[model samples]
Target: MKRKKILFFIYTMGKGGAARTLLNVMNNLDRNKFEPMLVTLNHDGEYEQYVNEDVQFIKLEAKRLRSGILPLAKIIRKEKVDIVFSTIPNYNMVAILAKMLSFTRAKVVVREADHVGGSLLGNLKCLVYGRFYNRTDQVISLSEGVKQNLVEKYKLKPNAIEVVYNPLDIENIKQQIEIGELSKEVAPIFNQNEKVIVTAGRLVKQKDHDTLIKAFAETNEQVKSQLVILGEGPLEEELKSLAQKLNVEDRVHFIGFQDNPYIFFHEADLFVLTSIHEGFSHVIAEALASGTPVVSTNCKSGPSEVLANGEYGDLCPVGDPKSISEAMTETLTLPPEALQMRVSKGEERAQFFNANKIVSRYGQVILNTFKK
Candidate 1:
């Protein structure tokens, strides 16, 4: 029997949550049943090396999104793709438009990767959400909160939206954690006898690392802990300066982006997230799978769901340094037995987002696109 071909579209295969989740889905799909193809705007991302040999990879090399639209449509028509799965808002719009221009029976599934809340692009974004989004065969939302936002803000029909959580390669994460160790430069930070707190994400306004640094400063005053930020972005110098101004620069380590963040997640005493909003947080789930306790700001959609409303980890109010600091101190100070119990429960919670189970759900969604 001929296998169905699925083309996954994204802007780039960068070290972001959506790219990681998309790669996980592509690598784990049943090869016998489906042929996976990845299409990116250009071949400029860290994840390019990780693409499976079985997956057909293409780069349009378009300088911008508008320029790539025609090339994408041509690929859709020429390859006779059975389905097109696209994530991120702008990319989603491009995929939908490309499918329209292709003029083929191939289905298009646009995945919404964030809670736009109707303000991201102002009127233009809202118009696209209301017009083009519903026009697609299906819309994949990362959480119930995102789905609700679509319906309320954009007035999308509920039946057209499906809430699909992002998948994690939990087994590979555990393996990497087992074999991975701290580098020579970073090893000393872990050896300082200070309770190590780690957070991984781009240093941007959305991540709200400013609040995290402040909270870390507060946590350090009482706990003798250190903060290790694992990702890099525009705010690097500013954040480092904040740490210095707060007098915790000696305790804060900006290690940039590590190829294997799972190692840091596993070795750290605690993992924290201070994002302003998220579709679904892969890092929190990763920390849970790594057997580390987590403290996260209760963001719009993902964290509360992943942590099960603070059952598996502590959830504090967003952008509140004092509350976050209190939670950090309390979680770090839990008794050994109590901490172990929470970690065990968190490990179980993380399994629900495991790739093995979540991939099949995506497969079903892809199939449903054709039916509609």
Candidate 2:
């Protein structure tokens, strides 16, 4: 029996959530059923080492998304790809155009990893999104909230969208935590007796680290805790300045990016995410898998769904430092047993997004697309 050929196209295999999620799906895909091909404009990335040997890796000659359209279309036709899977809006557009121009029998499946709030994009860009998104054989959303946004904000057909949460390697996270130790540089930060609050993401405006820093200041005044931020981005200096301005610089530690964040998650007392929006927050689920309590801005899409209306963890309004501060303080000061109960239940919730299960769902969606 011939396995279905799938071309997993993305901008780059960088250390981003979209890339990590795609890597999980690719690495975990059943070899007996699917032939996975990872295609990217650039071959060098943080995740290049993790690609499975059975999977074919292709790097395009073109470096930019626009320049790669014709080359991608040529590869799709030449490789006779059964299905083209791409994520992120720009990559999705490129994939759809490639499939359409390739004139092959390949089906196109685009995954949207961010909420498409109506006001976020310009009218022209929104029109383009609607056109290309509707042209695909199927659309995969990282969360139900993202699906709703695509349908309502972008006018995508509700039936065309399938919600598949980002796949998590729960067992791998456990192993990393079990075997990993705190590095000498960060070891001193964790040596203290104070409760540690951790938030990991690129230091970008989307993460709203400013709000998180302000909230941490408030929480610090009420409770003895340290803020440890993992991941590097352009906003590092600005965030650090804010921390200093708030007089929390001594307690706020920007540890930059980590090869294995799961270990930090396991060691931290609490995890917090203050993203302005997300299709699905991978860090929140990772925190849960590591048995760390979460305090997230009730951002559009992921946090509320994962937290189950604040049942498993605390949820606060987006951009509200006071609410986030209060939530952080409350969670930190919870009784030991109550905190353990939430952590235990959160671990169970994380299981729902295990790699095997979520990747199977994606495989089924690809099969259904082929049948169509």
The candidate scoring highest on lDDT is 2
- What tens digits encode model 1's per-residue C-alpha lDDT throughout 1-372? 578999999989988888898999999998887999999996599888888998999999795898889999999999999899999878888998999999998888888877775465564566666688878888889899888878877788999899989998999899889899899999998898779999999999999999999999999988999899999999999999999999999988998987789999888999999999988888999999999999999998889999989988999999999999999999889999998898899899999999989998998887877666
lDDT (C-alpha, whole model) for all candidates: 0.90, 0.90
Give me candidate 1's TM-score against the actual structure. 0.97
Decoy 2 TM-score against native = 0.97
Worst window of 10 by summed lDDT in candidate 2: 117-126
Q: What is the C-alpha RMSD of each candidate to the true structure, in Å?
A: 1.3, 1.3
Model 1 alpha-carbon drift over 4 Å, by segment: 118-124
Which tens-of-lDDT digit does each residue in 193-293 have in candidate 2? 89899999999998999999999999999998899999999999998899999999999999988878998998999999999998889989999999999
TM-score of each: 0.97, 0.97
User: Hey, what RMSD does candidate 1 come out at?
Assistant: 1.3
